[model samples]
Target: MALPTLHYLSHFEPSGYGLSAIAMVRALRNAGYPVRWTPLKRVGYDQVAVMSWPQALTEASHWLRDDESLSDLPALAVVAAVVPLAGAAGFTIAHVAPELLAAVFATAAAESAHFERVAYTTWESDALPVHWLRCFDLCHRLVVPSRFNQAVFAGDLRRPVQVVPHVRRHRTNEFSAPDLVELRSTLDIAPDEFIFYSINQFEPRKNYRALIAAFVQAFSSADKVVLVIKTGSIGWADGPFFEPVQVRQHLQQMLLRMRREIKSDLPKICLIDAANLGGRRMDALHAMGDCYVSLTHGEGFGMGACEAACAGNPVLMTGWGGQLDFLGGDYPGNLPYTLEAAPVWPPERPSFWPSQRWAACSIDGAVQAMQGVVASPDEFRRLALERAESIHMQLSEPSVAAAWATVFAAS
Candidate 1:
């Protein structure tokens, strides 16, 4: 019998799912599996000698290798072959939704073979959406980033569920002394100013508006504090796409209701479009901040919070969902929260929404947490340091990689 090859399908980009796919590939390869990568969208499998699709990733050129333009990957070895459906021999791992899997399924089915198929996904609701349950039928096993997600999704699943974390190793500070100096200067922020940073798309579930409300309410304009947000995505901006001036204007307008009571001493706020930034730059951004905040309704796994903590920035987050797996049972760095009914995809929209329950954080509690942190920097730093150590230990590279490879190997 031939060796069972590992065929992985996912985007080699920077979003949460994409990052998980990249990390899993690395781990599996490190575990010495014969792995093949299939890019979700267009990919150049050039004959230029590359072993992995993640090797093709370059933010400078829209997910292409630095040395190669996205011509066809001339080498057959670089591109994963569509396995035969009737008698296919290898296992297939898909990081895409079922609707998106139609093409992959068809191509793989064209050949006469059958092999194991596994699916990995991320979700934030208390229960799996009805639309996605059917997709699980196609997979032999389900792998999620958090146990919370596993519970929410496993209610009616046919296969076993497993938790594999998305982990990042400790990074060498990407910014030099001069780079830090220039960065603060460029953002019009002074070294003496205490900075609170948050990065996310302006979506309803992300609840950025709540963070803004709590922020402006917590501190005054006269205070030497700044809320630096790297966010975008407007009326039609699904996520990354940003209209900076317009987006900021929209946020200021959203604050109008509470503005009257803000006493007119609005906190100094800076908004930047989180577009076209590389990994190193992202690391620098996280490292430069005094605290990182992400106030979301729920998360399958709070990737941003994990990254911020790993970067050593104190995090003020909504204490709920999959994050609990590593944030500690009590969620030490998190703010106080309340369990609320599930919300639709767009919190603003009411009628056409999925049924998924999540937590609604108390803005007043957030205000208190913010005040408490600023009042004693040392205390918050200690808390952040403790969390950093705990999270890293739980999600060390070798352990996480081995866990991922185990799941792949099992199938």
Candidate 2:
């Protein structure tokens, strides 16, 4: 039988989406689906293009309006305005921006006959707009990664959405204890000290500052615990994508400020640039860490958290987004921790920052959790191994491939 041809579209390059897109494409391909990854250029920032169709149009309109050549003229403005309408006509559409609802409605009306099945993945409550409801009305299905996401969509937008847990690419080999030791030695991490690692891009949304603050507060007195942060540099306006220079500078400043605020010497914090770690080195680093920590303010899917868990490291993350879906409901597994149930809003949104409405464990809380694990190293190791085994079974590549097969067949 011929393999089904599935097209995956995005605006940003593949690497930017981190591992979620990587897992999806890998799974689909392994399932005998011929995957076509199309990175759209005729749009604004690539992030929008990766989203559902309506988002792409909305972004494109904003991009055009921002350009001096297109904004002033009435005719050009009208032409620029029609792009989302064209997109709605050609593809499955979901509106993520409230301002673009009218455009989405017009586009949906124009393209109602073209698409067999239109879908939207509501990663959060903010993702659902009134126009998204209109699109949902026209669409055959709505895709969501978690029950929480689906519930928000249903309650807020009053739309029925299907849940498909975020798929992950499986690791090839389990790291041996000896391998872990060697990796620790290579990184110059102490043999006896417990290591907590976090790998993420240096984005404000990642909440790295809070993680650093928490680490300083929690582990500064205990020289036996090391916090190894592996992150690339943050991007600057009109700067190269994924540049590490700016991020390195920022970290230096933050560390200095943190030292002053905490009134303590700098703790053992190692910042690793992803560019410095090749495949073997990356594997070794993952193997070396005793635990993986991610206190992201928000995430569509916590790929790093899942990857860490898969690598036989216990994951310490905020209860948000798809992380909850991966960890299951009864998470932390009776560990001395209180998991908070809350949604993290984007910092860009109004009344988001400084609002303690989200269920993020405070730095003190995370420190307490980390301290419990550190004090009982053997217990932590046992839990880590168990979590790794569970992840291996639950997110096995073959299982994900099977799920993709079903999705493709339906598509």
Residue lDDT tens for model 2, 1-411: 665444343232224342344455556555665444432332331123234334434544533333332232233223323333222323333323323323333444443435434343544323443334564554565666566776766776665555555565444334678877777777778798788888887754566777888788777755788888887655321111323447777788778988888788866888787766544455567667788887765555566777777776777777656666667656672222233333323323332323222344467767777777777777767777787777677676677666545543464
Go through the candidates in order and give each one's C-alpha lDDT: 0.68, 0.56
> What's the TM-score of each model vs. the native?
0.82, 0.68
How accurate locally is residue 210 in candidate 2, as Cα lDDT from 0 to 100? 76
- What is residue 210's positional error in candidate 1, in angstroms? 0.6
Which one wins on TM-score? 1
Task: Kindly list the per-residue Cα lDDT of model 1 for residues 1-411, writing each as its tens digit.
Answer: 334567677765567776666666665655565566766653332111222434444332443232121233334225344322343466777776444444554443434226577677777767665656676676776788899988876774655788887766433345678888788888899998888988777776688878888898889877888988887645322223322336766876766656676548687788777664445556667878899887888888887788888777788888887888877766556777887765444433232144556778889988988887788888888877888887888887777867765675673
Q: Per-residue error at 75 for model 2, in Å?
A: 46
Model 1 regions lying over 4 Å from their true place: 1-4, 42-89, 107-113, 169-173, 235-246, 346-354, 408-411
Q: Every model's Cα RMSD, please?
A: 5.9, 10.7
In angstroms, the error of model 2 at 43 is 4.5
